[model samples]
Target: MDAIPFLPLDPLSILLLFVVGFIGGMVSGFIGSGGAFVLTPAMMSLGVPGVVAVASNMAHKFPKALVGAMKRARYGHVDVKLGIVLGIFAEGGVFAGKEIMTRLRAVYGDTGTDLYVSAIFVVVLAVVGGLVLRDALLNRSSRPAGTRQALPAAARWVRSVRIPGTMMRFKSMNNAEVSLLLVAPLGFATGLLAASIAVGGFVGVPAMIYLLGVPAIMATATELVVAFVMGLGGSLFYAWEGFVDIRLAMIILAGSLFGIQIGAIATTYVREQLVKLVMGMIMVVVLFSRLFKMPVYLADLGAVPALSPSLHGALDALSVATLALALLAGAGAILIALARGIAAHRRRHGMLEPAAVD
Candidate 1:
């Protein structure tokens, strides 16, 4: 097989990558996953091949996740034991995912691979994003201050299941006993999606929350641990195959590290429902972005008529815009929430009072 050549890093390209990386990192730190969704498409837009973009994004993810996980852990949000177990099983899923990508690339080349990836992005983002948004809306309507958010029905059902021999208890999960069988598949799916698109937290966090009955804060924080493990293994696997571009990975990582720190801090200031809100909103916006690419990919595959050059260019531009919008929207929401939380905190402590008249 021929080696994958790295893209030229012009100054403009470098700056764009860095900015997008920072935005992605902020989202990842806040919600526990999503940086890759923006970073991958941004790289591809800069002329990097799809596989190479995915590979390089994975290369950058582990360290960023590690930093974010450490910060969140300080807040007592991380479940180390749960993360480790899920991450270990997720490695198998990574291997399986890599094999699938390899065969797809070998059989169908870059265009076909891109088509497959985009199609999955569209379907998964739409379905999962819609569900999350609905849940967030419901939570917003019914939840009161200082009260814990209610578990979704799916999560309630999951917790109720009792498989005697397969049950495992975790201190982080309120000492609740859940089936290993349930946790394993969720981890595997998380790893599989991460390998495929570099954003498995979409599945991982929600599954932890809604499937395994992990609380949103802990689930989101735990996802960083899962991302770290999966990313490390995935990066090594891709590097061995000569798909990773170290320069790209390093450039993106530089900005993402800083953004991740800010994001992790923001999580402490906001309600759990806001985390779901930001994630769902980003996913929905990202869904539209990927949707715009479908027709173009279809045309490339000759499954649809070729678009005019101008129209194709228009769609491509629209796709990029929407993806960036997803990042901006999420970041904006988090920052606003953080500011409000700070103001409220100050008010409660009488720190917002005007100075006494002289």
Candidate 2:
């Protein structure tokens, strides 16, 4: 068997890892879940095995999420009780999802397992992302003036149906009362995705904002809390198995700290409408990237060959290129948003200053 590559602790590798972590952290701070989506692939490209990449990423995520949650709490956006309840359920759900994944692997072997995961990624992103983009765009154009609007149809319906003994009111996020019926399912789905792909926030954040009567800011903030719970649990499990990679985790954490601080600071200056618009665009682009990856996995599983061998090779290359492009685009958008926010803050403060004495 090929020997596993030694832990890459070289200066260049560490620098590259730090940069990746910073970008990923910025994305996560803004969108709720982002570092693992790019960081895992980046680690694999750097010669880390897939499982180790995931374990190290999880280890890094716990502290980062804790820091982020604390920062966003300053903005009064975190729904602490709701996040804790959902996160606890999500913790259990992750184990269930892992059990399912193991069973699937046993039944179908490696190729089939890959195909199943890819299918889930494509389908879930397409449906959930499409809905989120639609809602964000529509809300951006037609939001009511002066006050926050009522929840979405899904949330309204969810709240209306009273499940005996499941109703709960959270003091945070404006004392919103909701049904655990809605939250548990969302939490479960979040856990399932997290276990399967290591980035449940994509699904979880949108679900909270667009389907569970939570504001976007609150949803994003609370997601960090949920991520912290899940990441902590996952890290412990991995550490017990000796898969926790401290060096990799530290490298990513170093960069993420600065990125997260910048992202949090920028949040104070941007209009909510613009945030929604940017989020909508991001969802659409990422959706297409996953869609492109689906066909390759399907072919691997012998489900269907949508392209010839040479064409498939080309498409695989295109998929990787597209993923990189998506990450770059997300990072670029984050930087632009941060810059604009800082400039706006400076201008506002500048306007408040008295004219210089002649």
Candidate 3:
């Protein structure tokens, strides 16, 4: 293997990474696995190599995920056995994901790798985001606090078709033990996404909720355990391949630790419905972030007509703007929920203290 060229951090880039990391961490904490979706793209925008951006993001994730899992556990939301079972399978998927990335890089270089990752981002985010968003709209209730949503038809179907040898009970789901057959693919996909772009929670959490019948709150919390397991395993593989950038990883991790705590606590205040709504909305918004940049990669690879330099720059700018909006939108929603939660908590206790951001 050869020494990978790590991007030199300018003052501006360092500051940018710190801010992005904090926001990303907050999102991750609340949703159980989102920071990497933003962090990887943000690093790539700063002239970091495609593989290195992903590698560094994965390296930063395990510690943050560990913190998040522990925090959410206090709320009695985590399903440890379920998470561990899923994560072990996810580890295999991570290995497969790295192979896919490395091969793409070797053949078509960074442009190829970026194109592949960006395409997946667009497709996966759009489908999952749209589904969750629609579900939120349809399921709106008068209740303030979130309750476990009714199981989806798919989940019911999955639970009914029990494989005699593969059924395993999970406390997160009410009755029916899901089959290992179903879990294997979902876990693998989660790990694959985690390795590919360091954002597997998007898939893992939703699968647990809509397919396996886990409640939204429990799904988000339990995914952290899966994340911790996969992130640790993925980092070792990426580091061995000389893709991990320690300096970049540490900076992001440092900022994210603080943000993750806030995000985790915010979860306690908000309704579970808001969790799905925010996760879905952010993914839909972030989809544009990738769409705006996809043409540039295609043109670079001669897969599409060449773009004028000015247009290319404009597309990149638009991508960055959308990414920023996604972060801000997520943060704003979490904070609002936190404020409302705090006020409600106070009202119930008949406390005299004024409400404030924690």
Each prediction's TM-score versus the true structure: 0.95, 0.84, 0.94
Tens-place lDDT digits, model 2, residues 29-87: 88777457667656654656545666678789989999998998998878888888888
lDDT on C-alpha atoms for all candidate structures = 0.85, 0.72, 0.88
Candidate 3 lDDT over residue span 1-358, tens digit each: 3356689888988888998899998999998874787788778777787789898999999999999999999999999999999999999999999999998898888888888888998999889889988887667654344354567899999888878899998888865688899889999999999998888998999899989989889999999999999989999999989899999999999889999999999999877788989998889998999899999999999988999989999999999899889989988998888789989998976654444422
For candidate 3, what is the lDDT?
0.88
Candidate 1 structure lDDT: 0.85
lDDT of 1 by residue, 52-167 (tens): 88888999999999999999999999998899989998999888887777777787777766777777888888888888898989889987778876666877777788988988
Please list the residue runs of candidate 1 whose C-alpha ends up more than 4 Å from where it truly belongs after superposition: 351-358
- Which candidate, 1 or 2, has the higher lDDT? 1
Model 3 stretches with alpha carbons more than 4 Å out: 1-3, 141-148, 351-358
